[model samples]
Structure formats: C-alpha cells, structure tokens
Target: MQFKKYRPYERVENIQRDWPNNHITQAPIYCSVDLRDGNQALVNPLGIEQKLEYFNTLVKMGFKQIEVSYPSASETDFGFTRMLIEDNLVPDDVAIQILIPAKKEWIKRSVEAMQGVKNGIFHLYNPTNEFQRRVVFNKSDEEIMNMAVESMQYLVELTQEFQGNVTYQYSPESFSQTQLDFALTICNKVIDVVNPTTDKKMIINLPNTLEACTANVYADRIEWMSKRLNKREAVILSVHPHNDRGTSVASAELAVLAGAQKVEGTLFGNGERAGNLDVVNFAFNIYSQGVDPKLDLSMIDEVKAMYEKQTQLQVHPRHPFVGDMIFTAFSGGHQDAIKKGLDYYRKEHCQEWNVPYLPIDPKDIKRGYEKVIRVNSQSGKGGVAFIISEFLGEELSKEEAIAFGHMVKQKSDEVQRELSKEEIIALYQNSNRV
Candidate 1:
C-alpha cells in the first residue's frame, strides 16, 4: 500500500474555539433520510410499496421530519411521494422532505411532485468543493455562486404557485472539503436571495459528504460557519454526516455542541459507501446520558425487523443500541457485577438506571433480562447463581455456586461453546446438589 499517496486535510486555526467547553443539553431536530439517502445506496432499491412501509414506520417512531424521496430522479421515488400525499398517510405534525439538484427542470419536477402535501421541505444541493469546481463542473467561483443564488430565486418563485407550506433547505455538497470562506460565501448569497424571516426560517445543512478530517476539525468548521452565517437567528444550522472515516457520530455530537440544531441520518447508518450516521445510535447515546432522545425507540426490535425486511440488509449483531448481544454478559467478572447491579437496582427501587456493563436499561428498549447472562468456558459462580435464581426461583450459597460453576465450565469446555439457559437448567436439575 502506498501510504504516501494521501494528503492531510487542512486544519482550522486562529479561531477562539468554544465547542470544547460546550455540551449538548437538548436533543437536536432529527430528520430520517432512510427512504432517500439510505434507499439509494441499496444494490436493489426499494419499490413504492416498500418505501411507503418504511415511511410509515419512521412517522410512527416519532420523527417529525423525514426525507421521503428525490422526485425527479426516479419514477419509484416520485410515485412514493404521490402515494403519501394522495393517501393522506402523512401525519399533521410530520414534514416530508424531497431532495433535488439546483437546476431549473429538476426543481420544477420536485415542486410538481409535492403539490398536494401539507408540509414539505424542498432540499437543494450543489457541489462546492474546489475539486468539484475545477474537475467536475469546471466553473469559476462567481459562476458557482450564481448557480446557487439563481436556484434559490427559482424555488422561492415556484413556492407561491404551490398550495402547501414549503420550507427551504440548502446543502453545499462535499462541504467538509470545501474552503470554509467559499462555503460561507455561497450560503450567505443563497440566504440573501431567500430572505428568510424568523417565522419562516431556512435550513443551512453542512454535510460531511465524505469524512475528510478528525471529528474536532468538523466541529471547528461547524462553529465557524454558525458564527459567521448571515442572519444566524433566522436560519437553522443542520448537519448531514457520512461515515467514511467511521467518525460520523462523534462529528454529529460535536457539531451539536458547536451550535447545530438539526441532524439528518438513516436508521442504522445505511447509505452510500460506509453509510450515514446511525440516528438510533446517536439518539440512544443521548438517552443513556439522562436526556430524552425525543424518539420512541421502545419498539426497537420491531423497527429493526422492518428495516431489514425492506432494505435486505442485516443489522450487525454487535451494532450499538439495537444489536442482539449488545447488553449480554459472558465474562465471569462482568456477569457478577451486572448481577449485583441488577439486584441493587431492584432492592433500592431506583428510578435512574445504573448497571455495570450496561449503559442504559435494556427494558427501556423492550429487551428482556433472560439473555443478560450466558455461561461458557469462562463461566463464574455469579452467572450460575443468576441462572438458577432467575429460571428456577432458587438461590445457591457461595459454596454451592462455586462448585456448580466449575462443573458448568467443564461442560462448556467440552462443547467448546456457550451454554444455553435451558441446558444450564437441565444440568443443575440433574445435579446431586439439587
């Protein structure tokens, strides 16, 4: 591998950084882009019916904003948008968003597709990085700025003819790679033309089209832009981070501390390349810290099942928050600590969740305690006692638990695997101690 082929990203300097001391005190506005960003990345994209199903699931999960489709890009996307409008499936509080390139014909088609929807966000994007300017579009800075300004003007004019409430969202694609000065200039120009008021605020989404630097650098950029954008109070600072470098979650969190008010992501980080930030992971991170995530994730299992069925993508068993074995304990030490914590939690009747090795209460997400501890070759007395107490309603003293633990360890070693709860129960039931 030629390690010298890559160049380091430029670092932000000379700015009085405040994000380091700041903390996220509230949940940001979450927008699920599962239907558009996540669906487009699939090898076989979802059909209209499947898209509708996913859309309904997101609405029920308490997402107030959802990017439903890109209407001008595909017939399936357009049809799905129409189906939601025609069937009146969208809730009164939900805002359905659609993405479109900053072009005349495409913007017109997007507007037409959203004719009957009550609440809509028309998302416009154009590539603004130096590479895209020199290599992709081959346009000068003045020309690129003109393109964004003209697109915003056209969108503003078209909204008057449409019958629903329409909000404007703009993204300078590849924003993490764009020069900070140029990115801010283009956004300010677009904002000037849009003339957003306090009552009707615009959204300026800074997307990490590709993760180009460390999470702190992204936070620095966000803070710089938030502080410099024209009419800061009249615009909602938003972020859409992709996980090319596996740091999208950190970037999103720091961006919030840096003054971002909105986040756009998929359910399980499913998107192009490494995918977008996982909204479930981000929200649950907040939930674990005693802050309300503002999303009803109690039915996480059902949500994961529907997502897999529609996307044909399996969730990793160790994925955070929704993974099957995320809260399970196997090591003897960990099992002992968790068992004691659970016992203390029940004995004290505590309202706050505090358990060793478990960040959040599994019951909060509809997970049961049945699989919290499993016996294996590394089994210990605490786990054996836990299994006996939980399954058979019996507790063993320290001596008995220790002796039985050794037997279970031997059995597990002979099988070279973890022992199931039922197998452990049978072994205990057949034991001379029983």
Candidate 2:
C-alpha cells in the first residue's frame, strides 16, 4: 500500500532522444555551490573564516564561478558577501554568486551586499512545481509568471546603478517536477525580460530540486527543453542535480550529454537530504575518460581533509576517485589481474591507462599504490604475494611467493582479521627464518 501510494514519473515522449548515443567528451562549466547548498545542510555551518578558506580552495581548484551565499536570508551571509567585496578577497577571474528570492525587499538587500563586487552573479529562484503553485502559494499560472517577471525587472533596475560586471541567473526550484512546457515557458520568459546578448549571457539553471525519475528520463526532459527554449544562443543552460535518488552523478552526466553547458553542485555531494552532485566525482569521471577536467585534483586527499575539518563530515571510504579503499583489491583474482596489468603497463610502456581493477592511476591523484593490496582471511594467495612483493619489495619466485602466501593467509585466519603490513613482514621473516 505504501508503494502504491506513490505515482510513477511521467516519461518524456521523444523519439529523437540523442543523449543515449552522445558521450561527454569535455567538462561542463562547473559552479561550486558548496558554501550555499553544502553549507546549509551541515550540522555546524562554516563561519566567515572557514567560508573564506573554503572559497580560496575553490579558486585554487580552478573554479571560475562559485555560489557563495543566500545574502538576503541572513546577516552572516550578507556580511560574508560584503567582506569578499570590501576586503577585496575575490579575484578578477572568479565570479562570486549570491542567491536571492524573487522578491523586491530581498533583491534590494542583495544588491547592497553585492556593491563594489568586481564580477558577480545575482541568482534568483522561486518554486515552480505544481504543488507549490496550487497549494503553497494558492496562485494561478499568470500570477506566478508575473512575480518572476516583475522581480527580474526590479533586480535589473537595482543592479544597473552598481559599478561591477553583473550576470543574472535564474532557477525554477523543483524544476524536474514542473511540467516540461511550463518550465520552458518560464525560463524563456525570464530570458526575454533580461534580453541577454552573446557577450553577456544569462544562466538558466534547471535544478533537480527533488529528483523523481531515472537519469535517462531527466536527460530527455533537458533535451526537450533545450531544443525548444527561446533565446537559446544567449542562454547558458545549466543543471543542478540533487542526490535524492542516489543517481545525481549519472543524472548530471546525462544532462551534459543532453545539452547542458554548465553544472551547479557542491564538493563531495554535500547538501540537503541526500546531497548535491559531487563535483570531484563528476570531474574525475571526465579525467578517467582521457579528458582534462581543468580542476587541480592531484591533492584530493588534502582537499578531503580540509572539507572534513570545516564541515565535520567524513567522506565515505568507498567514495569514487578519492576514497581510501577505491584502489584496493582483497580478492585473489582481482589482485592477480591488477598485478599483471601493472606489470604489462610498465613492460609495454603503454600510452593509454588500461590497468585492470584501477581506472585512472592512483598516482594521478597523488595516491600511492602501497594500499592497493591488503591481506585478510578472505584474500587469496595472489593478493598476499602481491602485497609482499609490492609493499616489502622482496624478490621472490612464483613458488616462493605461493609458499609465503600460504603462511600469510594462515596468520590472517588465526588473527581473524586483516594482517598489518608490519605483521605481514614479520610473518615473512619468520617463514624464511631470516
């Protein structure tokens, strides 16, 4: 009965859905929403100092656009926005963005916060979902449309007096749940009001505020709108995917294939409920495909450490690319294949990365190969031998390795746990009576 109460996601009817055949060969224009989206979800949100530190890290990572805060919502957010400007902490190349509701009082206050900003974005959002329209606001279609139009009109008027280069961005909150036609209409209408040119483009961010469908279906919706939206050439089409369905990464990848030019997400997928899209995970996905993601991820461990320190959130040990156990192999068959693959790679001097069980080299992200093999009762002889040879750097014949492997497995079994590298080495010395 609980399952029956939920309605199925309506499939987008498109015979020419090209995203399935398309591949993402390049990185999207990434906008990190870590401070706004990621920070809001944290149990202990970062203070100004922490936020500034995080912002600097994003800049160092080569993020061009970062949504810093919802300025009008709180005193702290407003102060942070001013500090970045008055303190001159923002770089000329980076554009610091602040979110604001489509309301005049908030917009006016947001404009005040953004004063003296060199390059900035005034992000406006309003819920456009059916439930919000019919029940929450109790407003008709025309009324809702007018609110967005008038807000854009007022926002433009307020920002015109400012000296900085300003870019406008709009998000139809809960965009994935809105009717495809209405979503397109609302976005196009906002574009018409802004009248963005090729030199100065407006961002239309379609957020999966509440993910309701499979990744492919979301791609179809994006493609459908991308094909039909007006002033398309002057608009930077973006997608902000939330990880409600545990498919935010897949959804973002498909959205890019479907014609999205920009992606708004947080590092490590930190956000409300499940989380936002993990930018590092998505970026490295491109890196794994032999494309440069443009972000400096070579020091991922350092970044992870900083993120954990600021947010007090521990990254899952099995998280892709930066995880502790991602490159590890405890299985005998896997260990054997990986060892063989690495050996072949070094022997053949291959240009392409084609190692078995490892996608990109761990060294590419500054991770060492020492932890790739660990010994336990479940591990095979090949794994134990691989660890001995790789970690201990002991030269052993196949026969000697097998003999040593048998000893390691028995010790691990006797201990009823994984054998540490030190313990394994000790076992090896005892086996040889060395």
Candidate 3:
C-alpha cells in the first residue's frame, strides 16, 4: 500500500490571502548606497570616472537619492564627492546623501564637503546596541545614548548653522539585534533631538546590519514601533539589511509591509561580509506585482556589469532575474509545461507582454536565442525541441526529439557543462549530415 503525503496544517485560504507578494506594485522609494556602503565593503572601489558613471547609471535607473560618500573617511572619498561639484554632474532632481558615523569629527568633515552641492542630504548613524557600545567603545548604555542624542542635536544644529537645503537621517546601527523597548526609546530621543520640519521629512533608518532573526518577529516590532512613534512630522521608517542569514531581502519586504516606507540597500547586494540586501530583487519584486516601484529597472544588466567591472566582483549566474538561468528552464517537465504555456499565453496576451511562466524572455535582454536552452541529463525533450526550433525555423518530431535526446545524454557524460544549441546542431549534422 502507498502512503499519502502529509498535508500542511496552515489554513489554505489565509495562506492565499496573506502569503508573501513580490512588492512590485508598492510605491516605496529605492535608495542605492553603491558608491558608499557597497564600495567601502569592496576589495577595490571605483575610481573617479567609474564612480561618476555608476552614479549616473543609478540616476538613469530612477533613483532620486543616492548615498554618495562621506568626505571624512578618506581623501579618495572626499575627492569623489568634490568631483560631482567640479563636473556639475549632480542632477537637479537627484539629491546626494553622505554617511557619517555618529562622531563629531566625521560629522564636521562630511558637513564641510556639502559646501558646493546645493541639493544634498546628510545621513548620520551611530552604534547604539549594547554589544557595540560595550565591545567597541567600552561605554555604558547611558553614555552611548547620551552621545547619540547629542550627536543628532549637533548634526541638526550644524546643518542649520551652515545655511543649506539639507535633511537629517540617523540609524541605530545593528538595530535588529537591539531590545524592542530600548530601540524605541533611542529612536524617540533621537527624533526629538533632531526636530525635523514637516515639509522635509526626517528619516530614522533602522538597519538589520546583520540579519539575526526571522522576518515576522522583526515585522511585529516595527509595526509596534510605528504606531508608538510620537513626533509624526513626516517621519519615514527606513530599513537597511545585511545578508548574514541569507534573509535580508525577505526581512526588508516584511519590514516594509510591517510599516517601514524607505529602503536603503546596494543595487545587487554587493557589500562587506555576506553582503547587503539586493534592491533590484526587492524593487522588481514590487514591480512584477503590478505596483509602481518608482524605478526604471530595465537597465539592471548594465548596472550588474558596471558593478562587476568596478568592484571586480562577479554576479552569480543563480542571481535572480539578471542571472543566467532566470528565464531558462532545463527540467523535462518544466520545459514541456513552459512550452505549452507560452503557446497558449501568446494567443491571449499582447505580443508586447511577456508570458506568465517567465518574468522576461531572455531575448528581450539581448541575450540571444543560442543560450536560451541547454540540453543535459536533467533537461527534457520539449527543451531540446524548443532549442532546435530556435536555430532551424521549424519543429522537431517526437521520434526526432527522442533521437536528439539520446545524443544529449551521451554527450552529457563526455563534457561537464550542458550542451549548447550550437553543439547540439554540430552533433546532429555530424551524425545526420553524413
């Protein structure tokens, strides 16, 4: 007798209702810190022209705000921020922001760099958790919080004193690990100290510097905090998550759903350690769901390329969407279903619209038809036939399909990688051309 598979205990109706959605339609803002946070984490950051090119690329992709660099960190960072001024490449619509730790000296230099650019914001952050306070500074909680409060007040006063169109944002670094009530208390005190204007919203970016917990647990805390927040003069809750646990993007999505509005991340999740949350994945997630994510993400492949060239860091083929196999299916069953699905879908939807099975046809991205199908031990007959049709302009018979499939399996044992369309054609010609 055969045993039946175990059924899930969760309510199917609720699962359908509350299940995770790709945040495609959500109107959340995209803020890429590629030049600053992502670059700092890299083994080799971008040069002046590379930085300029990357910054311009981000702006073209519809990012209105970018964390360029903190001038105080190094002469290199300082000069790059200055190049934006000398070249006048800073867009009127886009605002450049800088990252300065919650220290007086760094704040001083960061403020100094803002002298030339008229439209710029300053994001001041400090380590507030017990671990950082204890390990890094060997200071008490009272001392650290007091320093943070004073730091925000100092930053606010500094910006006002300088007479500029600046906005203030502060993050409780490594915030996800902090206690619920303690984090709330610090956030409140920081906001009160900053006292931002209504027209210019104050952002309190709470970073999961390292993703240390589940998304829902973090969501619950954020929801609880948003309702409790007092100084509501246009406060934007922000999230910056690192991928230590490989759940940064999930946590960011849940946190946004929980209450956070603005998101801070790298474009392709390039950063120190395990890396930062991928805003492309996070942004497209919202886009594919039919919501306006407020980003022109069509040039994502270019962004990934620039990043790889600049940082000398390669993107994994398994990287979502822009990766190698995102739109390609190799499994026999998957290929069969996808082939039939496309045929049926094309009849109904406009030719401009992509089928539901694939987020995008690889050809749309200029990847060409040659690499679309790779026949291997795992790939099915439908996949082989689809590849054959792409190259030859006609369909293959079931018998012809099987004949080709056996050749693929035999060839698979010979070469390590899956056979390309060209190789398959060469094999077919070698045997049948005779």
Candidate 4:
C-alpha cells in the first residue's frame, strides 16, 4: 500500500478532508491493453518489431496477463501471434491474451494463434447488444444468439481436443448495451454449454465497452451476473470497461467491489473513442487504499516508453501519479509546506510529524520531481517569506516581508519576471540561495 499505516498518533490526518475516496475498492487486477488497445489507437499502427518490443516490455514489467493482439484480423496480426507462440517468449505465469469474435472462422483463427503455447488465454467474445446488431452487423437477436452458440460449440470442441496449453474464455461483447436479463441468460446458458470447471480452467469477461450508463447500475448488473453465473470455484470473473463517458475507471473499480477478479484496459486511457480505463491510474488508486494491485509499477516508465513507440504519442507529463505534475506544488504556501515536510521527515519520523504536504513521496516511485517553491504571478508573501527565512537559516519577520517586497519588485522588473514570495526569497535569501 502506498499510504502510511495507522499508528498511535495524537492527531488523525483525515485524507477525506482534501480528496475523499468514496470507492469501496481502490484497485482491481490490471490487464494492460497497451499492446492491443494502445496499438490500435495510433494512426500508424505499430509494426511487428515494434509490437514485439512492447509485448516483451510489458511482460518484463511484471504484467502476468495482457491482451497481446487481435488475431483472425490480418496476416500481420497472425504473424505477431505466431511470433509470440513460436518465439517461446511467453513467461510461465504470464497469459498471452487474444481477442476474437464469436464466429466459427474467427474462433478457429484465434485458437490457431494459441498453438504450441504453454499457458495462454484465448478471449472469445460476440456482440450481444441491440445497437451493434442493428447498426454494426445488422443481425437479429436470434441470429446473434445462434452465432454465439455455434461459435461457442466449435470453441468447446477445439478446446477439448486442444493440449495442456490452451484455456477457454468468453465475453459478451458490448455487454452494457444489451438487456441485462438477456445478457445474463445468454451468459448463463453459455456457461452451462461449456461447463468450464476447475479442472478445465475458464474465464468469462463481461466488458462494459461503452460508458453509456451510470457506474453503479453497471456494477449492479456485473454483480448480479457474477452471483448468478452458476460456475465452479475456479472461474475467473473479468471486467473490461471503455471510457466513452469518462466513467470507465469507476466502472472497472466498482466491478471488483461487485465481485470481479480480473480487469482489462489500456495504459494511460488509450483506445478507439473517448478511451479505455487507464491501468496506471487504476493501479495507484487501489494501492493508496491498502490493496495489492499486483503490478510492478516501478517499470511504469518502460511501459510508457513502449506505449509511445506503439502509438507515437508522447505520454502526458501531467497525467496522474506518473505524470510530471503529480508531485509538483506550484503554490508558495504548498511548496513551503512540502519543503518543511521533507525537512521534518529527515529529522523526524513521518508518523510523528503529520503534515498534508503530499499524498505520496515522489521518490518512492523513482520520480525526479520536487515541490516547486517558486515566486510567480500567482505567488504570495507567505510562500516568499518562508523560502527567504529558511534559506538564510533564520526566520524572516513581517518587517522583512515588507523590505523584501521591494527587492521582489526590482527583480520582477529587471528579469521581466514575476517574483512570487518564494522567488523573491530565493533571489535575496542572505545571498546564499541567490
């Protein structure tokens, strides 16, 4: 957990006073979509070499399960899958996942991608919604249901004959748009037909691919399905949410609270429309709440680099915990608090010296950022006065603040700068910092 443990302190630092966590569960098991969703987002799709590099990078970063690619789409995709299987680069505990539609041809191609593998996940799904059926494919519910059944039937046949390598999986593609009861009935029926048990390990992924509804309602449906889906103990309940309405992260989080065990999304919210749930944000969220997110987040930079290579888009420095702005404090008062907090932390135990300077230390995750205690247009005397007195190893009085205000004005006009209190202090702090 990134947060500090409760101790016998006289003061109770209430985090809720600043930013409350109304969420019951902080994080879920992350299945990064950097390879599939991030790659697909780019105008120039990542090449085989680029894709392979990223694929290996995420695995190295300790992502045990990842959505590698969409097989049954093109030869380039097929080649990548073949390379993932042929190169034997997949780790023992790692499950290389592939997405396929609920069609016989697509299912076969998806299974073909699974050949000669050790332990891999085959994520098979079909459109079980009204809009997708009417607009995307123009298929009726009966037709869609038949396709689902037939595809699942073939998948069952294939998985049975398949070796110790393959694992069975399915998702009700665009499940959020489908009627809840119909989706549940279809999902339950598929479970009955497949009858995947502990011995024959399986997973059912219910993807909230479109953020068309409220998170609570979606979570209710997920919980209802998870509870009613008559499966043995070993079945893994997974969730994949798309952020069309900016509710994907909440939906994904609430799913775990509602009994989901696995989650799928792209790094930094890269996806087709608005985007997917950001796995990094999701991970740090839960870690702050005292739960193990099961991610080696120290390799966040490497994962981000791979994402950039896969999609030529620079990572936003101000995105979140990994963002450049995450650890920075622009306000002079804030910076002074941070500086004092660090100073006190150096001489005193953090538990003893309670301060609200930061949520988590920047260095804990290897980020090279400090509190920005600078004088700027929006700066004030409290900030400037603090920096001034501290740098000189003496306390600057109210009298000094008035005198320093002149020096601040002089420097501001000279440098064509705005001397915030801290900036003014830095400029004339006993000439040591200056």
Best by lDDT: 1
Q: How would the candidate models be sorted by TM-score, starting from the highest?
A: 1, 2, 3, 4
Which candidate has the top score in TM-score?
1
Model 2: clashing residue pairs?
none
As a whole number from 0 to 100, the lDDT of residue 223 in candidate 3 is 67
Work out the TM-score per prediction: 0.99, 0.98, 0.87, 0.84
The C-alpha stretches of model 1 lying farther than 4 A from their native spots are none
How does candidate 2 score on lDDT?
Answer: 0.89
Q: Write down the worst ten-residue block by lDDT for model 4.
A: 10-19
Work out how many backbone clashes candidate 3 has.
9
Q: What's model 1's TM-score?
A: 0.99
- Against the true structure, what is every candidate's RMSD? 0.9, 1.3, 6.1, 9.0
* Candidate 2 lDDT tens digits, 9-43: 99987448888899888899999999999999989
Q: Mark the regions of model 2 whose C-alpha exceeds 4 Å error after superposition.
A: none
lDDT of 2 at 116: 93
**Candidate 2 has what TM-score?**
0.98
Error of 2 at 96 (Å): 0.7
* lDDT value, candidate 3, whole model: 0.77
